[model samples]
Target: MNWQDQYQRWKNDQDLEPQLKEALHNMNENEIEAAFSGTLEFGTGGMRGVLGPGTNRMNVYTVRKAAKGLALYLEEQGMADRGVAVAYDSRYQSREFAVETAKVLGVHGIKTYVFTGVRPTPTLSFAVRHLEAGAGVMITASHNPPEYNGYKVYNEQGAQLPPAQADQMIEQVNTVADELAIAVKDQSEIEAEGLINWIDEAVDEAYLRELKSITYRDDVKRDLSIVFTSLHGTAHNLATRSLAQAGFDHVFAVSEQVEEDPEFSTVKSPNPEEHQAFEYAIAKGQDVDADVLVATDPDADRLGVAAKKADGEYHVLTGNQLGALMLDYKLANMDDVPRNSVMINTIVTSQLGKAVADHYNVTTEHTLTGFKFIAEKIEEYNQSGAHEFVFGYEESYGYLVEDFARDKDAIQSTLLACEMAAYYREQGMTLFDALEQFFERHGYYFEDLHSLKLEGTDGPEQINAIMEDFRFNPVEGAIAVEDYLTGKRTYLESGESVDLNLPASNVVKFWLDDDTWCCLRPSGTEPKMKFYFAVKGETREAADERLKQLKDRVLERL
Candidate 1:
């Protein structure tokens, strides 16, 4: 049916919820068209969209459809009896949506273990394995704005559904012809039948015990003053407790952002990557004379840090810088470095990480831009025994310290970061000073990310046009091009082509003669095209200049 007809059908449905009916009545023609244009996409990352009433938004109907699809897929595999785990963050309707998912799965005779309250995304990943469930579902949008929400699925290994399994899940999700027609049992009925189990502190204690196991240095000077903020999402309580349990006594919590507020009213955006998100935390840091400050996003999977410099001003560290610092600290302090240890990062990540790994005699591996790919390698190494998984990180503020959680764990990273800062403090230096020393030892490495947001109906077409333009056209000063969509790397100088040996994705990377590189890829979870640039030089000024020039040249073509 056309969008207009679909809009009318939704408007005319008597059983629609009051909130959706009110939203439908208030929407204009353009809003109606956008809402009914098509179903929200369920990709490898699962589905994410604005919160509202429509096929294209994140509502109860769409969530139910997704749950039903997962149920059918599990039943088909004869794994429904193994049960599924469900968790959500502090977003609006997150708990409601999670309960609705449980209801749908319950009606299909599938068991579910649902969290009693909000939990971090990484905890949900751990729950899947700890519970020995067949699958897992987390209701979150990570660091997206307050108006957005999402649903992510995980395999039995506690990792995000990989491409092959995701494709099959997408096929199952598409089989449900009508989103509004999926039936769900009442919550009470499901509870009475033992189909739904509520999980709380038992799992929390187990996860925390595992997190404490990752800490290596308990003898470091614990006198460091730290400021922490959850940005009004989950992780405030757990984060504070984790630090205290690890023997850090001077931790200060950002009072304004510590509570679980769905609106995230304290900051303009809940994302910790942006410097503006640290306004309250920085203020708290200044008030307490904190040696370092940390902020986690809504789901608490990604961490951001700002450390005090000699000038008494705080400098925010990029994801790449923090990853290198963490890796260096971990390897430097290890009593004995494992011979077969390996570190994993994405293709777009800075080369500095690989440099650090090489210094420690640890191997490095590269994957696509998702943590799941990194987790996939960890699982592979677990079975093959070729390499021990040491660390994993991506440029977009995600890091994984251990394989206990298949996704990024900001809690784990936060604890270790505090210890690293304290250990450096004993040397009478700050993290900023350590970072400069790191740059002096290694080449001055710099990186930046630029995103172009394109929303509405024509957004996808415009993005596709840009991708096609770069694919067929020759870029200036380019030596070779790696097109992940075609799974080939072609040398422009000679017409030689070779396989990338990675799964196909819509990413294109350029290798330049000057040793600087850039990559262009559409975000798998958002409606934006991201440009990643990295460069290294003998001096900081030279690296900064080269990075700017590379960004200018690449963006001018778009």
Candidate 2:
């Protein structure tokens, strides 16, 4: 049947959920088309879409279908008995979705472990490894708006399902033609059947125990005042406790943003990457004259910051700057890093991190975007023992300090950020001051990211057209252009091409002649295109000016 028939069938079904029925009643034809055009496509990070009552939306039926697919995939891999750990954040119906997932997996005779309350996405990764589960599912949309939710899959090793494995799982997901027909066992019966486990304090304690590896400095004076906000997600208790345990006594939580509000009452958007998310935290910091401010997304996987400068002025640190600062701290404070210690980052992240790693004699490796890739690298290194994974970061405020959690962990970064801030404070330096020193040492790396949102039916097509144009005619003065989708890097000067030696992805990056570069990629989870740019110069102003020129050159073509 067509989408209209599907919609009518849903509306005609006697057992249609009341909330979903009301939603269906309110939607117009265009809205229904938006919700029924197609299934929410699952890619590298699984599927994410607006929540509503349609096959294309993130609803119970869709969740059940995804869970059934994952269960089948696990059974095919012979890991079904090992089970899957499930978790959710503070989004609307997140708990219900998690329960539905467990119920579907249980109906397939697969054991499931689910958190009792809201948990961060990273914990799902950790719980999978910690419990020796076959896979994991996290119900979140990262930093997307409240209307959005997502389903993310993780492998047994506690990383997001790599593309190869996800392809197979998606094939299984697609085979289930009718999502509404799949029957799930009752949640209450699953527990009685010994197939469902409710986990909470135990996993939290174990995760916290492993977090000790990230406490870089123990003797730093906690003289620096620190402010942290969870952005109405899941970081409040974890971050504050982690700080207290690390001896950072002076800490304050941005009370307004700490509570779990699905609406994200305090901010327009619950994204930590945006400076606006820190509105409450910044206000509290200014009132208290705090030395630093930290904010984490709702799911507590991404972190953002605003550090107080010398003159009591606060400056928001970009993700690139924060990642570089942490990398500098890791390398600088170490007596001697492990032999062949390696730091990981994405292609679009700032090169400043690589410079710091080089200064400390650590190898730097680049991967396609996403924490899962870095997690896979860590798991690979653990198996091969070729190199020690020291730190992993991205330009989107995702950072991982320990391999315990095979994902970007904001709670871990929150405590470490405080520790780093306090240590620098002992030297009479703020994070902003340390950032300047990094510029002085690493030649002032300037970077910026701009996203163009083209929603509705034509969005994806428009994005594809833009990318096609880039492939044929790139920006001027490109020293080299690396197309990850084709695994080719073309050297414009020599007319030579070589395989990029990375997984195929829809990302095109151009490196310029004067140590400047820009990359273009459509966001996998959101309806948008992102442009990332970086430049280096002897002076900060020169770097900013060069960055603007480089961005303008690329923006004109797009």
Candidate 3:
């Protein structure tokens, strides 16, 4: 249906959710247009959007629609009886949305194990595999703003739904004619009937147990001071417990941001990748003269770190730098890594860590964009028995040290980063210092990201136009270009087109001369366009200048 018909369909529903109706009543013309112009789509990961009352918004109606689609998909696969594991974070309405999801599945006679309280997305991934469930659902927007929420689907293997599975689920979700009128079984009734059950401690215990495998240097002094903040999301208790279990007991929690504050009042945005998210943690670190400050996003699946330099001011490490530090630390320390091990990162992520992996004789692989592609590769490797997964990371503050949970896990990264800090601090150094040394050892590899937000009706069109112009129109000095959207790579010198051999996406990349590269793509989660720049140089200053030159060259044309 068109916007008018979609809006009218919600208005005419007798059992409309009151919150949704009120949101619609208060919306202005532009808000209405944005809300009804199109439905929030579920991609390889899942659907995410602002909370409101429309086809384009996230609400109970949309959550139920997604759950029904997932139920249908499971039934078609003959796996509905194996049930689904449901978990949520501390976002607004996240728990409620999770309860709604469970109810929808319950009404369809599909069993569910719902978390009584909010948990991290990684825990949910572990729960799915621990319970041997058919699937999993996590109600979170993963570092999105306070107004936003999301629905993520996971396979039984405890990874995000692969592209093929997500495609099938999307087709089923869009089949719904009217979501506002959809009804679900009562939560109390479902629990009494045993269709919905709360997940037990066994799953959490199992996940925490697996975390120990990532902890390498427990023999190091646990007295090193570290400040960890959850940014008012779901990482407080989990991080504390994991750190304590990993033998780092000197952690200081940022008191203000440790609680479940749905508004995320302390920071402008809860995203760990942003520097402002560490405001409270930095203050706390300063108070205690801590060695390192760590943070996790709302869902606790992405981690960020800031360490004190010689001047005593904290320097936040970019994802690339930290990934390199962790990669080198991991390879240099692990005594019994599997032979023929592999490491994976996305196409847009920096290659500094790749150099570290290469030094250790581990093969490096690149995925399209999301961690699901990496997870899919892990599954293939495990099945074929040709390679063992070592580590996977992305420039967007996502990392996976172990394949136990198949998704980017902040818990594991947090543990290892803390241990890394302690390991260096014992030698009178810090993580920032370790990062500089890493660059010295592995050559200076720098990566930067610039994002442009395009919201409302014209935003998507503008983004599409940008990609199209860049794809067809040639850049002046690019030696080669890879358009993942078309799944083709154009070798300019040879004028030969080769298949990209990766999943198709709305992304274009240009390979310049001398290890310099840039990638343009629309963000899968938000209404923004991201430009990723990667370059290598003899010095940090040279890399920054080269990056700026390339950035100015491309952005001026845009």
The model with the greatest lDDT is 1
Total backbone collisions for each predicted model: 0, 0, 0
Model 3 segments more than 4 A misplaced: none
lDDT of 1: 0.92
Q: Tens digits of per-residue lDDT for model 1 on 69-174?
A: 9999898878899999999999999999999999999988999999999999999999999999999999999888888999999999999998888888888999
- lDDT value for candidate 3? 0.88
Candidates by TM-score, descending order: 1, 2, 3
Weakest ten-residue segment in model 3 by summed lDDT: 174-183
Worst window of 10 by summed lDDT in candidate 2: 215-224
The TM-scores of all predictions, comma-separated, are 0.98, 0.98, 0.97
Top-down lDDT ranking: 1, 2, 3
What stretches of model 2 exceed 4 Å from their correct place?
none
